[model samples]
Target: MSKNIDVLIIGAGAAGLICAITAAKRGRKTLIIDHANKAGKKILMSGGGRCNFTNYFIEYERYLSLNKHFFKSALARYTQWDFIALVEKHGIPYHEKTLGQLFCNNKSKDILNMLLNECKSLGVEILLNTKVNKIRKNEIEKGFNTKTAIGDIKCQSLVIATGALSIPSMGATGFGYEVARQFNLKVTETKAGLVPFIMPKKWLHHFGDLAGTSVNSQVSCNKHQFKESILITHKGLSGPAILQASSYWSTGDYIEIDLLPEKNAENWLKQMKIDKGDTLLSNILSLVLTKKFASKIVSLWFHNKPMKQLSEEDIQYIAEKLKCWKVWPEKTEGYKTAEVTVGGVDTHAISSKTMEVKSVPGLFFIGEVLDVTGHLGGFNFQWAWASGFVCGEVA
Candidate 1:
């Protein structure tokens, strides 16, 4: 005989787990399952294991989507304040790290435990290491018939919270996109977001030895910019600023980096020439940047000329190069190191209020499976929570 459930949520990640708890609280017979050995793998590994649960300043503007306003409804309904309340209620100690990002004071496991406890208290059963092979729409039962390893299960509402194609080593797959196609939903172009950039060999050859060096810089591309510390990796650049700018970069685009974000590098260089400080250009730059990096810049660009030898026009050109140094990324490091996928099931095919398929009844999609992708920080988790909350209420 087939098992009957009111709600069947696929993938026991952040979105699925929260949805299951919400449905069970509504007196719905809910069962959440995942192919992995444990639930909330991403959550446990997020924020360097501290888990940035949500941002203090949650706004729809911080998110990117085919339809920008598609995320506003659900986010407005289940705001970050709502999630923070739940954390406080559960006695999970958390603190804001930076940029309004809230991370657990202890570890990410605390957040996972809290979600699991909520599910347990609500009587929601979570099945681990369970792979779902097939799903068939059931017009007769007005629901879905899903084929799992154990047996066939019938559910009134089916939710696809399977996430997207990032972190493949963690078992990330395009299964969610497959499901959307099975239902004939339009899926937008998918790409890696919030990822590092691998510069060309020529560029790396100039600064490859500077690997492990971190400098606070402003990276910009396509009218978008981020000011943060960028780390010089062996292959290219990797850091919060680079990751943020990578989201807006396309294949053939060039990114600009400001070596000095706080002050005007060009004006400082001009002052050095006017004052006739007998200091080498590199040595003068060393006051702001590292001595080695300053030496490298001088060697590559101007050949270590002294302030007395360089004219005001020469210094101006050098300053312009430092302020607007252009870089063409060979390519993104891809989904392996990416924090999130850029696009998925097109938001136009989804109802923003309920996260349900507009043409298909009793079927819903939420979290990273959808086209909405947030900027770095706690915005992504907030999206998962908001979308999952609204969908659970209806599903």
Candidate 2:
């Protein structure tokens, strides 16, 4: 005998769980399936376990999409304030981090618990460790027929919230992209966003040992810019500013890092030369930037010359390097460590209002599966909430 559900949600991450709760609250029989035994594994590990759940800055410009306006409807329908209200209702204490990112004061488990509790109150059925064998549509009625390791199930609506390929350790896969292709939807060029850059081996020899060293700098790619902490890793760079710029960066792209963001390089150097005329260049830079970076820049620009012996040309060159140090990254680390995939199901094929396929009735795409992908911090989770909320309301 075939089991029946009003809506069958694939994947048990943020989007699927939220959609299930919302649908069940409206008296729909909802079943969410995931191969993993536990739900929200990604959520459990996000934001250092406390979870950066949403961002205060959620303008469309913060997202990268094939059709940028496609996210407007859902985001407008379910704003960050709506999620804040739910958090307040659950009594989950949260606080805003820098740049309007909101994180739980406790742990990420509190978030998963709240979502699961909502599902239970709404009577949503959750199936775990379930392998889906197949998914097909009924020719006559246009309903979905899905066969899982447990059994076969039929549904009037099928919501694909499988997310994207990011943290493979959390079971992220290409299933969502595969499903989109199956329905004849155009999938855009996908790449790892919010991931680290891999410096060339030669430069790694020069910079990799500087791991754990961080600097406050202005990072720029093309015309986009971010003023945040930049960290040096064993392999390359990883930090708020670098991750933010990585989303807009591509192969062979030159990234400009302003080593001294607080003051004009030339003016600061002139002041330093006048005030601390006897101070070594390396020693003066050590006070403002990481000691290792200070040493490295001194090595590159000063040619082992003494600070007192510095020429006008040398001073000007150092100023330029300090103000605008440019490096063309060899390549990004890719989706294996990416926080979100850059592209997915084309927005042109999906309705901006309901997130439903224009041609394929009873089918929906939300969260990281759709064309929209948000910037670092909590914007991606906000998209998950917004898109899931809309799909749940209409599905």
Candidate 3:
């Protein structure tokens, strides 16, 4: 006999777990399942294993969506404070690392365990390593029927919490988007978000040796800008600034970087010329940037000569390049290394209030699977908590 469920949620990640817990607490028979052997793999691996759970600042402005205002209602309803309270209630020791990002003081497991504990306490059934082979509308029951690896089940409400394509090792998949298509819900074009930029071979040939060096600067692309440390990698540039700009970048786009964000480069260079005209330009740059990086910058962008040798025009040119250095990245590192997917199920087809499909009565999509994506530093996790919480109340 087919099992009957009031709610059946796919992908027992952050959203699925919370949604199941809420539904079960509401006296709804809930079952949450995932194809992965373990639930909350992403949560366990986030923030270098400590898990940046949420941010102090969570506004709709931090996110990117086709429907910019769609995320406002849910986020306001289940604010970051609510999630913070949940964390504190579980006695998970955490600290603010930087920019109001809250990370577990111990390990990411603390966060996962908290969510799992909530599920257990609410009597929500969880199944790991279970796959859904197919799903179809159940007209007789006025619900949906799902064929799983173990057995068939019917549910009045179905939630697609399967996250978007990001860390494949974490079991991220396009299954959520496929399900949206199956339901005839419009899905937006998706891309890698908060990802690293891959430099062209010709550019890497000279700068690859400075792979571990980092520069604090402001990176801008497509009118979006972020001030963060930019790390030089063997493959290309990968750092908070580059990753933030990657979300707004596209193929063949040029990224403008302010290498010396704090100093007035022109005035600094001009003063240095009068003060120490005998020093080499590379040597002068070493006062601010790493000696090796300064040398590389001089070699790549300007002629490395004594300060006295550089004319006024040369100083102006060098200053302009220092503050407004431009380079075209070949492309992003793609989904495998990306922190989040840029888009998924279009929010226009989803109800911002309930996270339910506008046309499909019992279908819902939440978390990263939706087109909504947040900036780096824990906003994505907040989105998961908020969207999941709101969807849970109804689904």
Give each model's whole-structure lDDT.
0.91, 0.88, 0.92
List the candidate numbers ranked by lDDT, top first.
3, 1, 2
lDDT of 2 by residue, 1-395 (tens): 47888999999999998888878878899999998889999899899899999988888889889796899999999999998899899999999988999999999999999999999888888889987778898778777998999899999999998888888878888888887888898999888989999888988888887899999999999899989989999889999899999988989899999988888888788777778777889988988997888898787667645456667787888889888989878898887788889988999999998889998899999899887888888999999999998999878
lDDT of 1 by residue, 1-395 (tens): 46899999998999998888878888999999889999999999999999999999997778999898999999999999999999999999999999999999999999999999999999999989988999999988699999998789999999999999999888688999999999999899999999999989998999999998888899999999899988889989999999999888889999999998998877877787778568888888888888888888889888687787887778778878888889999999999999999999999989999999999999999999999999999999999999999999989
**Runs in model 1 with CA error above 4 Å?**
274-276
| lDDT (Cα, tens digit) per residue for candidate 3, span 1-395 | 46889999998988888888778889899999899999999999999999999999886778999998999999999888999999999999999998888999999999999999999988888998999999998877688999998899899999999999998988998999899999888888889999998899998998889999999999999999898899999999989999999988889889999999998999999999999999999999999889999999999889998999999999999999999989889889899899999978999999999999998889999999999999999999999988998999998
* Prediction 1 global C-alpha lDDT: 0.91
Check candidate 2 and list the clashing pairs. none
TM-score of 2: 0.96
What TM-score does prediction 3 earn?
Answer: 0.97
User: What clash count goes with each model?
Assistant: 0, 0, 0
lDDT of 3: 0.92
Native-to-model Cα distance after best TM-score fit, residue 31 in candidate 3, in Å: 0.7
Question: lDDT score of model 2?
Answer: 0.88
Candidate 3 — which residues are off by over 4 angstroms? none
